[model samples]
Target: MSHPSMDDMNLNAPHSMGTTIIGVTYDGGVVLGADSRTSTGVYVANRCSDKITQLTDNVYVCRSGSAADSQVVSDYVRHFLHQHTIQLGQPATVKVAANLIRLLSYGNKNMLQTGLIVGGWDKYEGGKIYGVPLGGTVIEAPFAIGGSGSSYLYGFFDQAWREGMTKDEAEKLVVKAVSLAIARDGASGGVVRTVVINSEGVKRNFYAGDTLPLWHEELEPQNSLLDILAAGGDGPAPMNE
Candidate 1:
């Protein structure tokens, strides 16, 4: 058997979003959230790549998996949706957008590598969330999560997700979930970004890393090392810790 060359392996490696993306429905609207890490194998290609993509005025998608595949899917979906809206003379509903994604994902399952969560508010349905995972399966969910960090979050969501939550509560949950995942999952990191869509309009929020709540050992002080080092003298220049 001929072993693959290093160049062959490098060329075939996909740029992936080993991510934490979420779609949550609240009392009045839906919120989509995601971490911003894009990686190629073990190397981080982009520290802050926006995984949440806007599909229309209200509809948005949280993309996870091969970055290129997800981007191309989103782009195609966006164009199709634009035509859909023009023909209908109204904004496309959340279901329409999700189904389009499902069609593309499923039809090209053999060639594509991506999992998407679609979330938005429609005049008819009020608020909705859909999970389109690998192989083109579409599942409507109250709240949907995907990507590498999702394994760590299944239990967390079971305990934390509830019906009729207020908008603020849902947003808080998303931020907290991403932060917890960041602490545990090596592939998910960077800031958290969220999109809220409702009867009124769409709103976007950005949370910096420093502002997020620390979890587990992250909350513990590293004072032991710093204090020991400082014990001798002036202490390296009083590091940030």
Candidate 2:
């Protein structure tokens, strides 16, 4: 009987570091999304890793760059947030979470390896989106994005994104931006995963070209820009996103 080496196991692990993550604060809430592709060099590592993750019932994070680094830091920040809630008798806010991420990656920013979009609703601040980029820089923006696919977002956002968008409208914009990236960027593929934060709290969603977007089963990308545009500019499905 032969056994796989550690490198082989590592290669098989699901940590799609190469991705596109977007966060936007709309009229009364926030929406965050990511493509589910993890790649290493020329090979795709995993397609099903959840890049957009729940932090508090109200706060969530979208990760890009160094998969292991982001995952571990987010886990640490999660624990800290929970502990804060326990000690303070209230849930942690987006600002607090963003600060923690900043502190963790600060000073070591050059060596540290991740960029994050922290989005959530707060009692005092209302809907918020904070960017904790590499080098410990914390930027609060109405809309922000990161990762390999972010470069493709500039034009679409410049043309399509606007202020005071409703949640449904925000979702459409996110899906459209990600679809365009997946079509052009080889590093980003797989199903698009999303999370929304509002007065009611967090809403999680999944988007794809097919009704069932299962990465492990399909082992390939579902829709390209051409695939979506070819199907038509608008469709009843998430393809129109």
Candidate 3:
């Protein structure tokens, strides 16, 4: 059998999607983070895409995989959860929403190719994190992550993740994990964006790329590439809003 070439691979699977998204459950609530850069294969598609979305006043969802698929599934879950809450006068919990996604994906034969983590605080559950990947499998874990950027996470998360962390500790851990992932993953860059779900409700925050430590700031270029292209261009600076 002949192996496929890069050209064939790109042609046969013409979509490019990249991201780093994580969800963590701590003592009081759940924390979620996602990178802002949207990529298609090796090319950057958008620099300002928000992978973490508000599902409700207390619930948040982070998506990774095909942008279109993630968008549609997340929207569907959001709408479904919203209507369910309004109808019953009760907010949905992280597990409820995760299982809902699992149901929808299973019915669709898990065609979306998306990995999602639903995080939130529920009056009944306090704090929770749910992971759903392709195939409708729903996992209730203390922490969960997804995307190509996850390739760099094996050892990183094992060391960084811990239970009973305070809100502050969880937030900083999120920042560190995302920062390291961005530094190493060529397809995952741009500023790190996050959402925190607690009793106060879901709140979003961000870390501009410039605000993060430049791991390569001390490396001297063998010759110079910055001098050849755009003299002063640092190439894709972080955006502020």
How does model 2 score by TM-score?
0.81
Off by over 4 Å in 2: 1-16, 211-241
RMSD of 3: 6.9
Candidate 1 worst ten-residue window by lDDT? 219-228
Question: Roughly what TM-score does model 3 have, to 2 decimal places?
Answer: 0.83
Give the clashing pairs for model 3: 16-40, 16-41
CA shift at 234, candidate 3, in angstroms? 15
Could you tell me how far off, in angstroms, the CA of residue 26 lies in candidate 2 after the best superposition?
Answer: 0.9
Residue-by-residue lDDT tens digits, candidate 1, 48-135: 8999999999899999999999999999999999999999999999999999999999999999999999999999999999999999
On TM-score, the stronger of 1 and 3 is: 1
Which residue pairs show collisions in model 2?
Answer: 16-38, 175-241, 176-241
Q: Return whichever of 1 and 2 wins on TM-score.
A: 1
lDDT of each residue in 113-168, candidate 3, tens digit only: 77888888999888889888777788999999888788898688899888899988
